[model samples]
Target chain A: MTEQQTGDVPSARPYYQPPSLTGRPQPANLADILERVLDKGIIIAGDIRVNLLDIELLTIKLRLLVVSVDKAEEMGIDWWKHDPMLTVRERGLDEENRELRERLAQLEGTPDDEEGGQDEGDGSARGRQSAGSRSRGDA
Target chain B: MSDMPPAPTSADGPEPSVPVSDTATNSATNPATDTVTDSSTGQGSEQGTGRYLYAVCRRLPPGALQGVHGLSGEPLELVEHGDLVAVVSTVPLASFGEDALRRNLEDLSWLESVVRGHDDVVQAVAAHGPVAPMRLATICFDDDAVRARLRQWAVDLGYVLDRVTGSAEWSVKLLELAPQAEALEEAEAPASGAEYLRRRKAAVEQRAASSASAADVADDIHATLACRAKASRQLPPQDPRLSGLSGTMVLNAAYLVPDVDAAEFTAALDELRGRYPSLLIDARGPWPPYSFAMLGQP
Candidate 1:
């Protein structure tokens, strides 16, 4: 162990070494990994340890909070943007938007089937709640 | 091993053994102070002895840790008790003193920074060799206090080091999402109440099956990787908020793999990913052996 910031040496002491040595290499087993993840590992609790609360609440408190983004939007709750790391399923929307724009551009070339294509496109748009439809509709 | 009869108390200081103060902070009050007074008659007189605390262990090679400052920029000291070494620094009695710690520990940020700093140091030490990290918020009032603890927990500490000797931790997460498009399609499909009920039941059964499958896969992943590593241990699943991770965490498990088979464990995870598409498996690590330092010798 290096004692940083202390150039002043204490009284000359005998070099010490612990009798217990643990540097031997071993196989990576389930006991080791499970212990690593669940039992032994660095536990960092910050100003607000939000991440650790989920399991504690669900298991010990027996409380479940399932707030849908759609419902929250209706209630004027803006938790979606609070932490981008916790949000999922947004990629599907982006993929949908690209497909819709591509279809619209393809439809732009045909004049005779304008009304029919528009209706079909509308049906497809209603059928899919993907990002593509949302983006095209907003546009 | 013969107890070296409390290393002849050096003439420089009383009870100068490093172990006394190494873990003095573990008690509710200073161990030395506690032993001096009992509440039988409400006598609170103390023996006026200070303490030293062993926070985190980060192996700073022989010379890498020469200038690192502790919690308050105090000079840090190293107390080597065999192969395992403890990095210690003196904390003012006010911060760690019996009355003050109880009063101030509730301030979450202060406690967090101290714990994190402790962990950072431990990680550094673990990088070099197997480190038996002390629990969170362990302190000692004196060198004698530390040695008393060392004497008390020698066997426990040895066990902890043996379990983590050559292992590294890895994290794997599983997430599942019910696609909006699929839900919309089902809603739009022309069907009777009976058909709708059947569909709902099927969806429930599918969810159950998926959940069971995820568990099996997690177990399999653990088994496959365990074969490559020396030892492994499991941790409770964490919440998304605590983990700072993306997606609903279906399976959040960490594995301790040997340094020699680290690549093999990762490759197994990749193969597991390809084998299961419905459930997303994101793997990270080869991290320091943090999880292996369970309750040491005491």
Candidate 2:
């Protein structure tokens, strides 16, 4: 098993050159091009008048297509996490965790067993709601 | 048909004369014509050619668009009204007429090719001098109608050209970092129901606080960059899928910076990147000023 895995690494190396290594202008991504040409620019009425609302809806569809296709390809690879430029420092996480714990303690006070059960239900429900709303804003 | 008189030929004679002779011959052969016929709806009746306007330039350096092709792979030509020159190419009315355009714009692949082709010509003209790009699929019946639009919108076109002459557009987007997986595992398992609730509540509050701070950082970055640019506009954040990156986009903006100030604008960006190491500051530019070329009216 170790030998097979080791052999696979050499084969994959040729196919996966990072874009920055090429030292060329990365072709503008589809989303960037679509947003500029469709959503921006001077709008002079022409002989062929395309409905503005139709263009807006088409842009929305293209955005969704770009997101879903790219997202599926990125699912198992987690490529961005490995990018050196994107690697965030770990120092802030520890400090933030400490602050959060202290605030949580202050909010809960001395908890009883019965109240703890009720608080858990409410907390989890609120967490779900916040997550739902955040995703809604992105859409 | 004789009433329209040979669509005012340009001073240079040869180039504008091609369209002049073509329209004259067209008017003579295709005599199913009337003075009051609506050009937009008369697409099916004539089955003639239409001019696809790419961009209008202040003055194109001689032969700037030498080998560049337009949307239909047709050789590009210049339609000069006065000092203002319109970059155009002949497209068959069959594919580019009003009805055909309505159907074609809905197809994704067709739209992509046309958009790319339009940008290619705009970029070619922009390389030489100031260019005000037309909206996608702005076609006219013939050279006469093309000249008519230039005559009418001369002032606004001049204003757009003046505003974008020496500058280009730059895009800057800031994305917040998603929490690392190991960080979530750092906290030990909860001892009781109360502990679980405490952790959950803390997680929620932490998320809200961080997003708020990220928004502030985005605003600060925009303000700093805007000071270096001549003009700036904040566009709505793009979807993560389209951007091909994860994490919420906090700032999606376009800045119109003079050519001389480009270095200073980028330097400011580098400084901001260092200040907010947690953010992904994606900056790309010197694009044709698509966001800033709007005439006051549609």
Candidate 3:
């Protein structure tokens, strides 16, 4: 029975400090709880079928797939990451387009002479695609 | 499917579907339907109301929760099945229904409130005994359905409870951004356009190399921390926008550590923090055994 286990164990005031770079640490925020419950908890789910006559909806699967990227992969759920509909897929395409433009510029004998250069384009993006896409376009 | 533990035998018969007292139905509806209230918590009314389960625990004394409220300020109630007690509350069917969830799940603020409500009760339970949190928004058609689920998952639930009884979770994140760009003013202006292009490409390549090495360093640190805990899991690094942090997030790891061993774990973290002073390392925890409370783990 250590000091860490006692006190309000479930209080928002966490025993461990929130990391500095995470901005203002609100202890356990929505992400923390979500990450925990999504990965842990026992899900006891069933459709609530109302025995009514007036037009009402049928069964629905309400299981939320909200998980961090790594957690999703661990559970074999990476569809959205690869889904052609979402931003992750679109971002990949955008990166491909940018690199092709850069290469085309290079072939046209123009080496980013435009003001602010290619660095400006990179600075505007806070996207994850930039990191992984570098592998393909690298000469 | 492969990860699922051996399925427990369900309730011996169709003895589920507890007939919650729907006083309104006694005077109005068909007797056959009266026996089965579906999932609507209102019992007799067609209005879709059901109990939203937040978490489950064992050996929790009655009235342990007197003031806890769940989503939309509903009184939190406990449905006891054998030794297991599920923490739940009534929620409007129109709001929590499948169609509503499709719209509401995207609303972060709504999700946050519901999660907070869920945590308030779950945490109350965890403080006293082993608790296995349910996924966000698990609604049961009725108390009987909840009981059926309890019977269906009794074995796995017990396993989770026993493992997390004396442990807590910790999150460790590592961020190492590319090193500051080297001041190239010292180099004389390049004599040729090709020379300038070559230099720029080299700089980009150098930055990439450092980022690659930073990732390797983060991996090394995660391995070091994992060795100090009862169990460890690697979660995907959070997006910068979501986390409000700068730099590449190299590691997002969670560890299940016993209360007594927590000091040692922190000590190891501090040692690594000292070793990699330039890296941004965030460690948080003493959380309920979230990452570890899963089925099929020894």
Candidate 4:
């Protein structure tokens, strides 16, 4: 076994070496790491049985924590909007009116629906419409 | 899934006879012992030190993890069963126990550190050989229990290692760029209520068209790259808030590419970048094959 000194940092703490020295990319964002370690991997059950349901709920909480309030609002993640643990703030009149109008548009099956229907001819448009509406609902 | 190996025994090992009483005696005598001991009761039967399994790999060079530490700076140890080696460290039952983990996993900072620690070890092991990473916080009561798992799952583990050998996972995300200032200006200041509705409808149509084309571009990009990869998986797009990136993430994908094809794969990515200048193609990796290490999923 050829032992290579992968740690290049001059610090006395060998384990704290910069990740670059090992040729590994810098530590990815918390979301990326959590997604992989929590959601992916070889799940061989061990003696300690952690509740997977709790972990799933925790993942959702982390997702909410990481998302910016404005972006979460844009995505229509309203679970926390009224949660007692999270701040409950009134929506601005303009924002409320916009949501009402968008809901009305969907109900009316207006021009937006027509454009969406026409775009779905190729089968990719419906996904795009939902994704767009989720993020760019005001538009 | 039916053909997959039976899920490894949880809590109940093949040898329930492995003498938990002996472990309790050892923990009492050795203050630093990793045996699970119930803190509240100061007894070993209820709890003792659990071996936190980070990953399993084949032929890890002796001392490859010399200076590396496991979660909570615990010194790592290797438990070998045949050619498979489990990289593990002792975690106290106080925190790593099932109840403790349930609470700790909810704390973002705790989860973040553990996740990073897990990745760091996986990366260190991957530097030597292919590693099959364990999900967060997989623990065995003792080395015997760990070996029981290793013995039972050896075939599947070997299969996973074989599949991931000489390959790495790469993350590729495609984001749609924000609309130009001119486009935003056009939607503002409608001359009349009729014009306002018209502008709103037009804006919605424009967004729909742009998003549709962006989705097409994303698909094309994934297809072009997937051709160069050994295996590919499209994960859900991450939230912009978590990624600290602007614009809509249209595609989030992981590709397992052999080391030999890495250069060509990157070249293809560069070419795609030039072809779709409007989309932000965020590519990162050569990471441990986290996405491809599944035993039966392949």
Q: Which prediction has the highest lDDT against the true structure? A: 4
Interface RMSD of 2: 7.1
The residue-by-residue lDDT of candidate 2 on B93-162, one tens digit each, is 6677767777888987888888899999999989988889888878776566677788889999999999
Interface root-mean-square deviation, each candidate: 15.5, 7.1, 8.1, 8.1
Number of colliding residue pairs in model 1 = 73
| Rank by TM-score (best first) | 4, 2, 3, 1
Best by TM-score: 4
lDDT minimum window of 10 residues, candidate 1 chain B: B1-10
Q: What TM-score does each of the candidates earn?
A: 0.52, 0.67, 0.65, 0.70
Worst 10 residues of 2 chain B by lDDT: B1-10
Chain B TM-score of candidate number 4: 0.81
Q: What class would a CAPRI assessor give candidate 4's docking?
A: acceptable
TM-scores of chain A across the candidates, in order, are 0.18, 0.37, 0.22, 0.36
Q: In CAPRI terms, where does candidate 3 land?
A: incorrect
lDDT of each: 0.45, 0.65, 0.57, 0.66
Q: Which candidate is the best by DockQ?
A: 4
Pairs of residues at least 3 apart in sequence or in different chains that clash in candidate 2: A67-B241
Between candidates 2 and 4, the one scoring higher on DockQ is: 4
- Local accuracy of candidate 2 as per-residue lDDT tens digits, A1-139: 3445554454332322222211123566666777888888878777656677678767655544432333312222232223212211221233334333433443364353212322222332333232212121122
The residue-level lDDT of candidate 4 at B101 comes to 83
Interface RMSD of 1: 15.5
- TM-score quality measure for candidate 1: 0.52
